[model samples]
Target: MKELHKTSFWESLMIQKRVIGALLMREIITRYGRNNIGFLWLFVEPLLMTLLMVLMWKFFRADQVSDLNIVAFAVTGYPMMMMWRNASGRAIGSISANISLLYHRNVRVLDTIFARMLLEIAGATIAQIVLMGVLIAIRWIEMPADVFYMLLAWLLMAVFAVGLGLVICAVSVKFEFFGKLWGTLSFVMMPISGTFFFVHSLPQQVQEYALKIPMVHGTEMFRAGYFGSSAVTYENPWYLILCNLVLLLFGLAMVSKFSKGVEPQ
Candidate 1:
């Protein structure tokens, strides 16, 4: 007969942390390698995308110019959008890529998915910070109006991203085709994700419907924090919190149920 091992909750948590840390390093090395640019590409990829979008908007917007800071608008909107976008998208095939690691009992299905999500979120976050710093240094964008509020929005969005990623990762295990389609589908989500236009600027009727999307609240909250009195925003933090909790519960259950069918290969 095989013996079973028991661990206290704290012990189990510590062990999970160690396992996730190892997997994170492995992901960085395997995906990015140690060559030039290497892991830096994590942030650089999103940073460049955000920069290009900013430049394009700055140089060639077809609309009349407004007093709003375009650089800050893009910086706040795009990176926050990318965090959730890439988190769930990248989580789709994390299981297959790290299937071999499952042979080690300490590693888990959740750990692999989490490591990828963490990497994606980290890249978006770092790129945001770096880009904002540079822009502020150059006087292209003013400092954030309420750093704490912006940070709260960022944190809530991260939670939302992880919850969304878990659900998607679990679903992908059941539907291989979904894994293939998510990459393109996520891009389609960007425009409507509130990354470009402010909800306040939208028609009142359209704004109400737009607010129904969870990501919209996150972006609106973040923009409100950035623009302060200058921006009129409709953000319900508690509503977003409720949505996060629901996604997390549903996602964790889905992941656990689907993972049981996966074998160490």
Candidate 2:
């Protein structure tokens, strides 16, 4: 009989790191293949979509807004929203896509889910950075006022996205209806997500309702950082942090509950 030896926590962590790294590479290759620019599409795709939105806003809302910088507004808001959107959206298929890999001892359902969400988050982050740099170089948008605030908001948003993805993944795994309806449901969530509107713009009565949304805090926090004293923003970092914690805890519990029951099939 062979006796089992347990690895130290550090050792176990390293092993999981290696496993996740391999999964990330596998995902990139599987999604993009070895064709032209392959993984580069990760960022390029978001950049293009964001560019299109920026152009559309420039074309349509030219005279509609005299106070705000429409170009900067679109540039900052859309990509951040897309990060969470893509992260949560891609999480649905992760378990099924890598179902075969689950037979391995090192691979986990959470690992597969994390890998996919991390990829989307990385792509959106890179696209946001690159687009901002280019736009600033061309004088299309000014540099952010508070870089620390901007960075913090991005970090919070990323975590929020992962939490949401975990919950969405768990729900989709448990119920077929959620998996099928997530696409439509996500669209309905977009407008209210603080993507296009500001907390200040909404009426006093509705502002409280808007603040109830964690996504709004993230968006508002990000814009506050970029727009600085020029714009009036109501962002409570503590509230967003609280929401993230609750969501993350609930999501982890749900995923763990469902994953144990998920055999190879």
Candidate 3:
């Protein structure tokens, strides 16, 4: 029993590490290929999107929310939300899209899911740091007052995203329509998830409803760290952590069941 346990432990640690490293390298190269700016699009794309959103919002809602700079406000929540959205959306189709690779017994479904999720998370994190650096350089945003909270928030958000992605990956494997539903739901989540604005700014009833989604709670914690006291009200940090743990367990259970029961058509 001890020997089996030790073998399992080593395999889980060493094999998963090897799998993640190889997959991550593949993702980075495939995303950029042999180019001068290889892998830079990971940051460039989000920064440009943030810039566009800021310009559009400024043109329309400039006077309505002048006190909170829209760019700074966006910098707080948008990238985090996009990280979840992009990771979950792609994860949902990961199995189907890579069915060929999974047919090889060595490439487990969980490994693929982890690889995809990590790729998206790493790309998004890099983009966020670069954008924040630019904002700081231009004096549009200040250094985080609580860098620890910012780090913690990002860690929680990654956990939250991976949990959500696991659920989506399992469902999409069994029901292809799940991919479409994921896309639709991501749009629905955008306005209500507090990705572009602070939660307290919303009406009380709206805030209560938004808090029902764990992602909103995750984003609130992230924004709190980035904007500090200026972020308005946030659910307790422990509450967010507890919710992420529950979601992760649920996602793992779902994926395990799916792997056991479902085979590709």
The TM-score values for the models, in the order shown, are: 0.94, 0.95, 0.87
Per-candidate clashes come to: 0, 0, 0
Q: Name the Cα RMSD for model 2.
A: 2.9
TM-score of 1: 0.94
**Candidate 1 least-lDDT 10 residues:** 1-10
Two-way lDDT contest, 1 vs 2, winner: 2
19-66 per-residue lDDT for model 3 (tens digits): 678766776787678688877776677778766765676567763755
Q: Roughly what TM-score does model 3 have, to 2 decimal places?
A: 0.87
Over the full model, what C-alpha lDDT does candidate 1 score relative to the true structure? 0.91
After superposition, the stretches of candidate 2 with alpha carbons farther than 4 Å from their true spots are 1-7, 61-64
Highest-scoring model, TM-score: 2
RMSD of 3: 2.7
Off by over 4 Å in 1: 1-7, 61-63
53 in model 3: Cα distance from truth in Å?
Answer: 2.2
Q: Report the backbone clash tally of model 3.
A: 0
